[model samples]
Target: MGSSLLPEEFEQAALGLKSGETRRFEISLPADHPDAQLAGKAIQYILTLKKVEQPRYPDIDADFAVSLGIDGGDLERMRAEIKENLERETQRCIRLLLQRQVMDCLLECAALDAPRTLVEQDQRRLAEIARQNMEKQGARNHNAPISAEMFKERAERRIKLGLICAELIQQHDLQAQPEQVRAAVETLSKSYQAPQEIVRWYYADTQRLAEVEAEVAERNIIDFVLSKAKVEQQPMSFEALAKASQSLFTICDKRPEAKEGPPER
Candidate 1:
């Protein structure tokens, strides 16, 4: 958005030029200028103004604070709460990064065959989840057909990782402490309005507690792996940690094969 009719020096410099005022400047384009072929060119320019406008912003007052869910319009309290929330998020991301690294390392080291039956069971489970998602979206083809092989590889990977975690848990005699489970439950319910009721709902169900315990056990396995593995302390910022892709486990087949290895479809 430049005017060719006016020289570049005038430059539409409106920020300094106030309302109801006009000014002019001149510029000489050198021979090396992009538009100049061989010789320099001189030109003159004029400036004109119609009006000036300044942006209007709402003041950071009580009303503004209340709109943002801050209580009593205490800006200091808001800052403290924001800082605490960001710290929690940073901790969560660090855990995710460590867990991802541990899982990938264990998957590469653990050599185990994925059972066909277990893989098939997980395939059905994943397929059911997909159908349920479609139903939630109010789709007519909620139970639409899908390729059976679609979830096979993913199921196999998940099953293999589960098997490895199970083995590690038994070998290490790892226990998901009651306090850890309670902490997990509290973290899960913190964002809800009725956090106590949410916590009660989880505590009332033994099956749900068992699920949390299983997750804790897996996390303990990650900790155990980190303890013995050659450790390196690399510092990372919260933004980097949050933006990182928390990768799940995968394995590459380096198995010896006859003839040629075919590309997977």
Candidate 2:
């Protein structure tokens, strides 16, 4: 009976039985049943028995191995893959911890009040970015919908950081010059196949050029902060550094716009 019905239909049938409704069952085996595989076959059993019970999975072993499309030998490879994934996750967590510590310290030292407008703008920008990312991945974010209140909180934090960073930049006089911008463009070009085309495109629009310059200026600020910071030069692996940078950037990416006021006291 279960074999002939969909999962939903099976559940409904079970529910009907529980509700004291009469349900007739007809059972017959097909001609292919004798030759069918039994290792992971779905078997349908029917009887005039008054009670129907939910099935429970058995303990895993050699039989379970056949169900997972892997033999005992293949299990080792899966274990190795799981170990690698765990290591990566651990490294990522460590990086996030470090980045959070750094940001929290900076925020404490550089206390600033963010503008409502700037916070709203940053929240909107974040939502737009998330939507675009979902679109690019060909996936819809049905589970995590964006809300204005949530955005407001995120935007506030971002705006505060932006104000702090902007203040730092001004205090240090860290501006990206034309030569620095050109050098940055050249460095970026090396990553593309058509270097000249990329360079041309970057220089073609004044706004685009300014955006690149701003990025360079931000990097300069990061470098300057590292210089002034009492960093304990921990000898981390390349993977650790990559993970740390990713975590650091994730926070930096959400920095808020500067408010229209003097830097926070």
Model number with the top lDDT: 1
lDDT of 1 by residue, 47-152 (tens): 7777765568988777777776777898777677678788877777777677767776877888888999988887777667656656877989777865446567
| Candidate 2 segments exceeding 4 Å error | 1-104, 140-145, 247-251, 254-265
Q: Global lDDT of each model? A: 0.66, 0.60
Candidate 2 global TM-score: 0.52
The ten-residue window of minimal lDDT in model 1 covers 253-262
Model 2, range 1-265, lDDT digits (tens) per residue?
A: 4443343444454554543346644334443231112212454644233666678986545555545544563656545545765676665555455555555667788757888888777777766655555566687663465555545555676678778768877999888988999988876574444668888887888877877777677666666776778877567765555544542443444533322321121
The runs of at least 3 residues in candidate 1 whose Cα sits more than 4 Å from the true structure, single-residue gaps closed, are 1-60, 192-194, 246-265
**lDDT of candidate 2 vs native?**
0.60
In candidate 1, clashing pairs total: 0
Model 2 worst lDDT window (10 residues): 31-40
